[model samples]
Target chain A: MTTDDQIIRNIISGEQHAFRVLVNEYEDLVFTMCYRILAHRHLAEEAAQDVFVKVYRKLHLFDQRSSLKTWIYRIAYRTAIDHQRKKRVRTIELEKAPMVADSQDDAQVLMERSDEQQRIRRGLAQLKTIDATLINLYYMEGQSMEEISEITKLSKSNVKVRLHRARHKLAEILSRKQMEAT
Target chain B: MKNWESDIWRYLASELMGTELESFEQALKDDPILADKYESAQRLKRNLKDFPRLSPNEGFANRVMQKLPAGLNRNLWVQKLNRKPAWYFLGGAVLLVVVTLSIGWPQGSAASSDMDWTQIWQWSTQLPLSFVCLISAVFVLLLIDRVVTR
Candidate 1:
């Protein structure tokens, strides 16, 4: 296993193989991040690929001031967010046309939960983007609050507050659904 | 429920830790309403924990690798060397030496006596004038050839 520093040096030295090694190591992490953020397979894959290309072109600009993983993840997060923004704009443009004949079916399909498990996923989806991101990073990825704060550029206390609110929102959504079902 | 209900729930979810955890436990113990909120929070956390992960399908790695940019197989040293400005400077230096030696050799052998210090200095002074005249002559000849061909 090549150390992160060694991989960086190899990349700087123009070793194509070294770039491959670096990509192989971080591909899953980057892809997972994009997947979580985008929630669409094709878009997530494209975003992940774009992130690697950006990393390759901008590697020389990397100052080694932070860990390579953190830098890469930061890039991945930004890229995913940018893609999501663009996608939202496109969706808004399409919203003018009564494009949906039966939007109710989609909501019904989403509501069919075998257990409370689906409620959590639904709640997660409904939470604010930053809140959902915090939960994913903190719970799903098992990142420390400090790491989450660093990634999101939020203060530690702010991250705590957000995480607290995010979980509460999710719980409230779940409970509401349960009550409606009864 | 109190606003702290979420914090209490997060603590039960194992998402909040350390001082936050102790504080939340104390809050839950003190307020019955807070404890009831904590129970719902625990259920939600448990459901989330049990939620199935949507892993990327098989061949996902292959798909990603296939989409990667090309030109990754090129030789590193060659690529680096091609990008270095020093190589162009070195080439220019070699060309200068070759041209100087080629021009100087015939002149040196033809006028061995004129190659002496005083004569060499005189020749060096006239060299720029000779170069200008030679360039003009080449241009004139090319012009004449074009006119004749027309």
Candidate 2:
């Protein structure tokens, strides 16, 4: 298992295959970010490809000051946002949850996961992309505030404040949605 | 005590440490509302994780890799040109146009009324339109290449 720094060094030092390792590692993460932002699988896939290509071009520009995950995430987020703007697709309310883990999980767990996903998707749909993204990164991805601040290019204080507000808003939206559903 | 919201968030985010964390834990044990908020946040966090895990299609990495220029393979001229932006191609096109106009304008301007129809025909053929056409064709090819490649 090569360290991220080693992989980065190898890529920069003219080992082209080193980049494939990076793509394999962060590809799902980039795709998820793009999917959450774009809400379209086709567009998200396209955005993910663009993000990887951009990462290759900018690999030489990356200083080792930050973690490669943070750098790639920032690229993913920015790329997704750019695609969302260009397409201007209307955010649709999620009607049914796809059970990606249905085969692996017991029925009860799958049910909870499906319900939870639906509620979260609804909450996200109600919020702006950045707000939803902040909550997604902090909670879903388990990113620290400092790491998220770097990815967002926001001050630590600002990231913390905004994250709280976003969560609170999401909670409110979820509560409202449950009320209506009930 | 100053900003309990920060404390509550830090506690939920697992960012609280030592004394601050100890005090918050005590508060959570004592206050029902605070504990309820904590419970709500925990539920939210767990549910958030279930939002979705979207992975690209199977051949996604290969497609992206194919699109990526052979960065380390600098020996490949196509890779070298592929790395340049569409703006560079556009600039090359504009430069070609300038050179063509500069060469064509002088000779075309000199062909006046004294030149017969056949002379006019000769002058038109004398202009470097073929070279200009070739350059323009290459420019269009580059533009199409950039759009398609991206």
Candidate 3:
């Protein structure tokens, strides 16, 4: 497999296809990050495109000190946050969770899962952009505090404290949502 | 009670270990409020852990590649533009307006009166040579800036 370093070298050497490789690797993660912040799939897709475009332009400045994943993540986070800040006045619309159906049982389970996903998405939409992002980096992506710190530029302790706070806030929102649903 | 939230989150995350873990679990069994908090945190953790993965539509990478060339060209143009001061463009625009007025005012005046071509030529020639040269220089510089940036 071509390593990340190799991919970067190839891209810097004018191998445009290498960028596709990089984008393919991180596209879902970047899209998910954007979706978490923007709370709309269409906006998330646009933001993801912007993130890749930016990464392509700024690839030369990567420096290789941090992992490529973290670097792309930082770019995705910042771009999504910028979109959110600019469009704060716009109402958020949740994208319907996609369903896969191979069997009746599978369809049933997927429907339940989709409902849960929608609930989580709604809860996240209620949060401030930074808080939602912190929760996403911590739980959804399963990033280490140190890695989250690197991606977010927050201190490790700050990441920890803020992540905990965000977790509590998300729990509060989810519980409130559940309370209302019943 | 004040620290119960973090404690419950820590427990849910398995960040609490050994004695801390034991004590929190004990508190969970003893205090109904702490138990309730733990239950909620555990549920949230489970939901977040199982957070549905979102994917972009197919050919996402291909679309990105298609966008790359145009994006690169635009970025290069912007970076080149940024290297020069805005005042250069502003000066060019101001000079262009002045040149248009200088040339247009005489034509306008001539058309309004019985003044013929010679009178207009004389008026033009009577204008300061230095001002004309300055306008030419500004126009040429603006053209050169545009070419170099392009």
Candidate 4:
């Protein structure tokens, strides 16, 4: 129930439980972003955990120039990209990328598990890491372009240009698949 | 399909406005292909938006929390340095003055060759005890910086 500033202040004051609250608060956002970018559960988990550790290490340097969410997302995006590069996987490979975890309610999950795993993940895999991350930030996370630019270190114009390219690429890939099926 | 590159994107992202928005809207109604592409693009965005989110398994928070505390206590001096840099800055300035003053023996004089250990000892004896303490403090500061930065 504590405000983010109060949580940050408590953490800077060396309260261990305050950090726990922070980790809990942002774990899902960090983990989901990592998983989508890397398309590997284990790597995403490691990256997410590393992000929190880094946040703790660098907490004292948080100068309050940006909101806590923006700062943390920057760290998360940077860490995920670092791990993704070190793994040398580049972008997520649809062939190897795991299907979204199994769920009875998820028809897409069911479809992905069965015959057409490549339908969407393939298009996403073709995207550059920055481009895929742009889609995730915009559509999935609902971040504004300004925030996306801050997180990705791209200029606003660059974000707009790249996001448009990414969307077009996805449409082309999906439409090509449909044409092939017909 | 091809023409939807920039305008359709801006329209669906709700970024297009004023004249540009009206023109795109008119085009959407006038052109079947453009309208179809817009619908498909919207579907693409909706699907991406609804992409499944992955949550950390139970106790993920505890695992990360457990790893943080050990490193937190490792750099005690850095914590102090971050908290109060002014004191350290002032201390460093005083140390510089003391070291400079203490080492300020008249040098390269006409009698430089004749200066001996006895003369050096005499020069040292003339310096205040506080100068010697300041040199020791400088050494301690260097050691702390090494440890903290390591």
Candidate 5:
């Protein structure tokens, strides 16, 4: 398989076909990162598309100082954050509406595992955006601290400390849920 | 010893393994509190790892592809070169060459005499203004191109 760097070089050199390979390789990771941050599939999809478009436009500015995946994920992270900010502004203009109450029967139909998973998702949502992102990048995405530092532009030490704190916070959230269940 | 609870927990998470592992394990064997914290840390690590992965929808790629601009298929060099500034430069250069040739090429009998000393002096004096105008026009065109493209 062609490396991502090779594909990017080819794309920059005018082979449009090479971009398709990059899109295929990174779409899932980008989509997942956006989804984790935005928590809405449609918004995540839009963010992902925006990220790739920015990537294509700005590829010339890419200096090869970092890996292609790191650069792309950095773009994805920034795009998702920007989308969220815009969404927040728009949401503020609308009148607050009461959240729809799920029917008891519908709630009961969800499996315990599914419910637990939802609780974890909710706990993740409770985290500050950076903390949540650090957890997602470190755990779900299986990125190293150095890679996370590059993507987030944090120092390696900061990445380590923040990740440790975020994990503890997540564990506390999960433990509280476990207690509530019992 | 300084409190290595955090370090022990970090090691268990595999974030602090390798070189630090043996020293931490040695510390753990001697300190009961450290061992207890290590156990809790291990549980937390397992719990975090066990969270279900979220997979993208099957049409996710198709949806993203649909949102991209159609012209993105063009080659990168072609795309970059096709920007307004490049075209402006090319057009300006062509116009400069056309204007220079037009002015220098005199009709019939005048063509030879155009190079004569007196005529050459006249042309030399007029050339600076024309050159300046051409340069100014090119500059203005470039500025206009940048604003419009933006």
Candidate 6:
């Protein structure tokens, strides 16, 4: 396995093909993180691509103070947030913006596979971006509060408090959805 | 339902420490309702953990690789220049002093032990042209880098 430092050095030294190793390694992680925040497959894909482009441009500034993955996660989080903000602005301009249709069938198929998972996703989608991201970082990725704090630039206490509230909110949403279904 | 909901999440996260963890465990054993809530929270956690990770559509990596700008290597040089400009300036200054000293004072001006205004004027005139040439050379190199990378 080529180490991250080696891959970085190779890319910096003008071997662009070496970048494929990096893209391959982090694509799923970056895509999943983006998807969790954006909640649309096509938008998430676009955001993930944006993240890689930013990473490539800024790779020279990576000082190695933090692990490569954490740095990339921070970039991914910020990029997705930026995309979400731009998306919100565009929706406002359009007024009565169309629903994101690309991912609906994929989401429906996945929901059919597991009702509870879909319920959780619905609950997550309703939460604030920060809260949902915290939940994804905590439960889905199993990141510790400290790691989440570093990635999100929130204080440790803030990550804990938000995560606690996020879980309760998710539970409330899930119970309400269940009641509706019954 | 109660404030213990926060405690349940903390405990699930394994963030509750020492006495806090102990107390939560004790409460879990004592209160049937709390125990039931804990069970459900645990189930929710399991579902979240098991949630499938979504991959981007096929050839996602290829798409990303294709979209990567070809100018990154040239940008890296620009970034390096932006990061440590002092070194380049110092090198230029040293080169300027060496070139000036190597030209040696005009032989007649030095022998006469006089300030030769005409000699000084000629040297000063040549200095600006040399500086301009140096800057143009740098600009041309940058232009070449940009074109080649593109």
Find the candidate with the highest DockQ and give its number. Answer: 4
For every candidate, how close is chain A to the native chain A in TM-score? 0.78, 0.86, 0.83, 0.85, 0.83, 0.85
What is the Cα-based lDDT of residue A93 in candidate 4? 60
lDDT of 6: 0.73
How do the residues B1-150 of candidate 4 rate in per-residue lDDT, one tens digit apiece? 236444566565333222367677787788787677667667666676666666866789988987774754443435566634645864886777677655666566723888878767766674666566666766767665554433
Q: Give the higher-TM-score candidate: 4 or 5.
A: 4
lDDT tens readout by residue for model 3, A1-182: 43998988777666666777889889989988887777666688889999998888777666677889999999998998888787772323442334443332233234435666667766776776777788778777888778899999999889878877777677677776777988
Model 4 over residues A67-175: C-alpha lDDT tens digits? 7888999999999989988997656465554555533223433443433434666777777888878888888788888899888999999998898778767766777
For residue A82, model 1's alpha carbon misses the true position, in angstroms, by 0.7
The numbered model that scores best in lDDT is 6
lDDT of 1 by residue, A143-164 (tens): 7777787788899999988987
Which CAPRI quality tier does the interface of model 2 achieve?
acceptable
Q: Rank the candidates by TM-score, best first.
A: 4, 6, 2, 3, 5, 1
Candidate 2, residue A172: the lDDT equals 70
- In model 5, the runs with Cα more than 4 Å from the true position are A89-118, B1-40, B50-53, B73-75, B78-150
Between prediction 1 and prediction 2, the one with superior lDDT is 2
Name the 10 consecutive residues with the lowest summed lDDT in model 5 chain B.
Answer: B10-19
Q: Each prediction's Cα lDDT score?
A: 0.64, 0.72, 0.71, 0.72, 0.67, 0.73
TM-score per model over all chains: 0.56, 0.63, 0.62, 0.70, 0.61, 0.67
Error of 2 at B115 (Å): 58
- RMSD, candidate 5, Å: 9.1
- Fnat of candidate 5: 0.26
User: Model 4, which residues run further than 4 Å from truth?
Assistant: A95-118, B1-27, B30-34, B71-79, B83-150
Best-to-worst ranking by lDDT: 6, 4, 2, 3, 5, 1
Give candidate 2's error at residue A78 in angstroms: 0.8
lDDT of 6 at A94: 17
TM-score of chain B of each: 0.28, 0.34, 0.34, 0.44, 0.34, 0.43
